[model samples]
Target chain A: MATAATSDIKWWAGGRSPFNMEYGKLMMWYFLMSDAFTFGAFLISYGTIRFSQNYWPDPNHVFNAFPFAGHANLPLAFVSLMTFILIISSVTMVLAVHAGHHMDRKGVIKWMIWTIVGGIAFLSCQAWEWTHLITGHHPVLIDGVVQEIGTTVSRNPWGPDVTGMMHDGMQVTKTGPVAFGGYFFGITGFHGFHVLSGVVINIIMLIMTLNGTFDRRGHYQMIEKAGLYWHFVDLVWVFVFLCFYLI
Target chain B: MQHSSNTHSPEVTFHHAPGDSASTIKKIVRTTVILSVITLIELALGFGIYMLHKNPDPSHALILFIKGVIVILSLLKAFYIVGVFMHLGDEVKNMIMTIVVPLMLFIWFIAAFLWDGNAWRNLRNTDAGHRPAKQEQVTKPVDAKKPGGIE
Candidate 1:
């Protein structure tokens, strides 16, 4: 019955859409929507494995180190800084899009440069973190022997000391379960790849802007599309931060 | 330089002018400031909880409440980014729903998977038919090492 009454609305009558969006932009939105699901699945699996364990490593212990802090016990401070950088980059991307809307070519270029710099800064920070995690901190004396601890698919230094019985007077520290490090590397590595690709795309867009390709077309729809992709990347990081760092 | 050859070209239509209004610029600045402030608050709350909590191992309820708050705040940031930065807020209702309604399935998928995975874990641990000897061997060492047992 309600459907019959709604037939009077001309836009719903379906000859043309009232949503004034281009075909390309709408398609990009649909693509991002699907990509979001891929990230969602990764995070959900991480949560499942983490909660099912008897003793999961606490996030505070795992992510305490920050750049130049010299091993200060700052829980999640580095990631919080990363989050701020990504958000600021998103802001710059949007400002570029806004400038595009106004046909301000120089504004677009400037803001896009800032966005690219932000992406590079973020990637460098991630590199530092990965280096620190892979190499690990100072060695600890376990059962009368100094053992160097680090992160790997099978073990991590953060969790309970899973060192098993000494064989021939050699101590064996078992560390955490295999799944913890596996998920940590897999999820964050995937996200880092996304950031890398976003940087490359932004560079291409920046070059085209300089050459006046968009100006010749008399529209900056390309910039808008790039902004959508950049913002989606930022959105995914928000959830990743919660899954890996906070929860 | 090619005006003579381009004289017959069709006139191009532009969607926006060469510059934005002052009010539009102001709005952009305001949104940026708001986003930065929210992020700062989230950082403060997270570190504050860890620093101020009396117990080294906080109560389960307390941790759960703090986790809930953090999740809500992060979602708020997502909302602002999608709505303002992506320009979806000004879009028509039908267009907005086209992106939003389908995404709800993502949350549903996560919830369903977590529940099923938890059940599998429980079954694997308790049901002898599922694991029998292997499960016993794997859990025995860890169970023995748990607190309140001989270290």
Candidate 2:
């Protein structure tokens, strides 16, 4: 009868009542849902600002990096690599969870380490990309002339003297308060901050797992919880890629 | 809950479990090949639009059509991941829907905002020089050599 019930009990039916899972998985899912909303709000705000602006620069033009050759239209590559890394990490995570089911501590640890490494590599690449963008590697076309976009008014769409650089790396001089640079920094910076946070969380999990915390608990729920967060991170990146890179 | 050693029921079996290796590697490879072909088609269409369309400003209608295709492709991929890899395919309907439906809404909300916003920007580009309600007398003629509505 119990075996029959096991096969028959629907997940949502069980969702109503507490089952074998601890509060950890539920709380993790709740946290992921909240994080999803945060990313959604950011994307919506990005759309609003991009729409309001008259002349948005092409994403392809702004993000071009030729792999090992020269900086050239390869914005998609870093993001795509990030996507693959996250997906591969998630696969490893699932394998960890499977190992947990069998009580294979060593197997779980091996996979968890791999996932953590992928997360760190992804964060590093994102940091490099963010620095390049902030430094103005790609200049915008102003008034039909291409010029350096940083604090120097080498050239711009609004004609000469429209923009200038400030002493600090933070401030950029442009035609008005709502120049393109402001919007670009605001959107990309917000997403980059999320990646940084995700990296920190992954590191924390890695340290805990290494210390045999998860092994002692005898519950793979932590692995599943980490998977949920990791998957959410990857999902947000997909949208970020589309909105910031392809769009 | 009994913690049975028997594999008779296989309580929490993974689709890609490592070695009795229930799923063949060939199956995973086949799925990849099929998905890659679809992605190639999308790439071809994207390049075709960029090359053939003389009008840089795609009308709202065209944007909407392209947006529809993008959403469909994305949904298909999402479902494949959830079903095949997540092993939610053979699960109950409510569970499957629970995983899939919210994603659809999420994609729709973001795409709608992006499409509507880009349309407004393109329209503004047509009247780039004139402020909507600000009336300023033109003491000097507008610069003819400068491209006014260029983006």
What TM-score, over all chains together, does every model reach?
0.80, 0.66
Model 1 backbone overlap count: 1
Q: How many angstroms is residue A139 displaced in model 2 relative to the true structure, after the best TM-score fit?
A: 5.7
Per-residue lDDT of model 1, residues A1-247, tens digit only: 2223433546544444456456677788989898888888888888888766666777776788998888588898899889889988998898898888777899999999999999999999999888888887434445567576688776565545445644435344445666878888888888989899999999999999999998897767889899999999998998888787777
Q: For model 1, name the residue pairs that clash.
A: A163-A173
| C-alpha lDDT values of all predictions | 0.77, 0.55
Give the least accurate 10-residue stretch of model 1 chain A, judged by summed lDDT: A1-10
Name the regions of candidate 2 deviating beyond 4 angstroms. Answer: A1-3, A6-21, A73-75, A137-147, A151-188, B4-21, B24-67, B80-151
Question: B15 in model 2: Cα distance from truth in Å?
Answer: 15
> Each model's number of backbone clashes?
1, 5
Question: Candidate 1 at residue B120, lDDT?
Answer: 61
* lDDT, residue A155, candidate 2: 25
